[model samples]
Target chain A: MEEGDRLHLGSATLRSRLIHGTGKFPSAELLAQAIAASEAEMITLAVRRLHLDGDRRSELEGLDLSRYHLLPNTAGARSAEEAIRLAHLARAAGLSDFIKVEVVGHEATLLPDPLATFEATSRLVAEGYTVLPYTSDDVALALRLAEAGAAAVMPGAAPIGSTLGVLNPHNIRLIIQECPVPVIVDAGLGSPSDALRVMEWGAAGVLVNTGIARAKDPVGMARAFAAAVEVGRLAHRAGLAGESGEARHGYGASSPTAGLPVG
Target chain B: MTVGDLEVEAALGPEQLRTRLRASRLYVVTDDLTPLEKLPDLVQAAVAGGADLVQLRRKREPWAELVELARSLQEICRRGGGIFLVNDHVDLALAAQADGVHLGQGDVAVQEARERLGDRPLIGLSTHTPDQALKAQLLPLDYIAAGPVRATPTKPDSVEVGFQQVTAAALVSRVPVVAIGGLDEGASAIEAGADLVAVVRAVCAAPDPRLAASKLRQEAAAATPWRWIRLNGEPRKSPPGETVLELLARLGVEPAGVAVEVDGRIVPRERLAAELVSEGSALEVVHFVGGG
Candidate 1:
């Protein structure tokens, strides 16, 4: 696989261009059906301390995990210490290497704390886990996380779940340019066009959950998102039309009427 | 039985009327006392700007002239895909088969109007005091207009009810109460919890009625779901498979002040729904991102 083309997580090489997260489904059965229909290679699962009695299982007890590489997230953690503790608990729950580190500072916006995120990433990386820190679109913060041994730096395009579409494209582009680790544009996505936009910005992969899970038809939206992600990735690799100011005789090469005589 | 029959009745309550007017961008006041000849153009202008509800307030005109003016406004509203409401004129409302009628205290009695118009046409009543509001509830009212909230030039003779009356009416009334009279700015009236806002000269005389109406809608959205995400990480349940955009639409959350995040990543708001939701993943919804 080419350097810019491949999306890798530790040893796993996912074939599907899209990643899926399971939330907002009406029922577990519906969620499973939606996931199966999406044909996504990787899926995210949230892990927290179980409150149930001995050997208690999750609602996803009946789900078949054999096909999916469960990427457990430390979603509820707010501080670096809390995230590190949750990461350890996730490992105890058999989600050791693949940990989605989410350290939120504010309760309302759920904005990832960049400071806590890098701190947790550094600690986790030193502890020998493949850490993926969810941070903001701050290019400097993303670079710092990469240096902290984060396998991937997931920078948000907008606040989590606003679905406003990519609010800052330039920052994401800069992060992809300066960071050595793979850049995954995550969060604030509302539509397929947004997924395509980030991929066109040269993100290694795009991870989505709410946009699909919250749709009126999760399965159909999944298919639409898959197509968008593929088109965006392909267009990125094909080389896109660079944004230029003076309308360069841009249409001359592509338009048949360019060579034809005009009155 | 048809959508129109249900809609005509449904547009009675503030909630129902606001939902119906979701696509309408116009703001017009028939009470302007603009001559019948000039009224059609003004109504058309508001409609052109997307005003879907035009009320014919004929306080200055006598009964005969008011009825004649209503028929003309009704024609304009028809072309505009809007509702023509007669302010304080049950007889003209019945004559026009107007989408509904809005009545003040001295107009026709609520029971008499309902008998004349039947259960189909929407009926809205104006209440200035809490006692009047409580009495309105006993009568069959689709919605209540609480105000004269601020002092405005539209009704120079009308008393200013202040924000307290509006809030009292909202708290006491069983039906949806729209704050009327002088709702010039968004912060005060909306923060007071008025369901649908009604402005006369403020909206009608504005340079751009569409933008004026949009500003009110923005205000209403801001005041609602005030705390978008309440407390720690408890996911505000969005219906499964809705794009954050679609979810917002379903929840009646305005397009602004809401964001979508998936898999610990901020999916550009555009791509959130373009990608599908994986089963059993966490989805967080936040609203009212801006302002004090």
Candidate 2:
């Protein structure tokens, strides 16, 4: 198994392509266990302002954060200004400059504001922040972000925490094919199969948060997703047979036709 | 030698001068209302009290006397680390070796000023509307002054453009927008995106010019006059004089794994702190992040 491939993001190179988000987890213990089980070298945590006098401990306090690269996200920001401010606050708190630019436009759906995301990405990039913008499955916007100097363009397969899996494989495929920077499938994914499907479609990687965090057996699901990503990447690299609309090619048997007794 | 080359020879490049202009919060324009003999004291006091730039606007003074005063004021500005500019007199600015000249709508064309002054000295034009500010972008201008933000006796014939024009002009201006006219405390103008707030009576008419300038500077600093730059491809505001490294730090961005580009060229990481982010600069800061 040729597993020597590395994920080059901005300046850091990682062996594992599975990126796990620390959101919607049932408990700190479970979240920690799931993270360990997933084997993801990079994990995202949302940057939120701590209360003035609140006794709340950070979600990252107990975890051995040295094992993973901390990618702070501007998850709740609704505008470019807010997202840029949040990225700064995240860095001010001693987190790395690696920022996930997520500007939510629609509240109920938590759909990313593509315009704001792009705006934040550009501003953050201008301020020397590594920006990964979470946008919709719009290929053009993805390319635009890449051109704007996004480290990687994360086009959501579906809405955040929706668990609907890849809704537009065609668009995702186009994004992966056209984008100069790495195209990561983020959001709208559920189950290990969904992760595998995108990885097989030539995505650099997949970001799974709710899919594993909300599962009944989160640790088990994390392990499954890790394996799926690896296998899918291998399949893509090995070169799967091309799909065809013609029945002869679509339903063709793998066995040699000429050597068969019936032939 | 070209005027720009002279400026460079003087160790103040156009970019450096523009950066200083953008960082300037208080600009004191001398008035004919103040006595000629008292002008030097007023300028020294204002500069001491935090005025970043002082303009000699003695419209009625004789050329020789104006030149003498301009030379003295230029000395005061240089010693105080403040910019000295002549109002409407390119020759006076040249004679005194002033930092720049501020032009009015009725003064010599900006093209003519640039030709005479060369690219070295800063050339600021006074604009009354957003249209004028937008048009100023086509000229070789270093900055544009907008407003009489309030009605004043200095320009009684001209209507007060208000803070609205200041905001509009700031939006349209590719150069730094200086909000002028009847300004006392400059918080409102700074909030409206004016890079520097120019005043006549606010400091000059005050019993204590230094205290008045200091108060206005404090007020302007509180509101923070943000310099506009295209980041990524979007218009964004940054604090004036913020270096590439400080910008990253202010945003809580780590220097590691980050690349900074200003205009179209990449700024090496080691030079981030030295490179000042000026107005109308296009910067692209990039770094890696955790993604799929």
Report the lDDT tens digits of candidate 2 across residue range B130-215. Answer: 78887887899888999888899888888998999888886556677899988888799998878888999999999999999999
* Top-DockQ candidate index: 2
TM-scores for every predicted model: 0.45, 0.48
**The best candidate in terms of lDDT:** 2
Q: Candidate 1: misplaced stretches above 4 Å?
A: A1-5, A51-57, A243-253, A256-259, B1-292
Local error of candidate 1 at B150, Å?
A: 78
Candidate 1 residues B1-292, lDDT tens each?
1354333222244455545643332234654655667777777776665455678776776777777777777776765567678888787888876767998898889989988888767788888998898688778766788888988777789889898887777545545567777676555654564555677775566776556655655655555311112111432222234354554454454433233445454445556457554433454443210000
The candidates score, on chain A by TM-score, as follows 0.89, 0.93
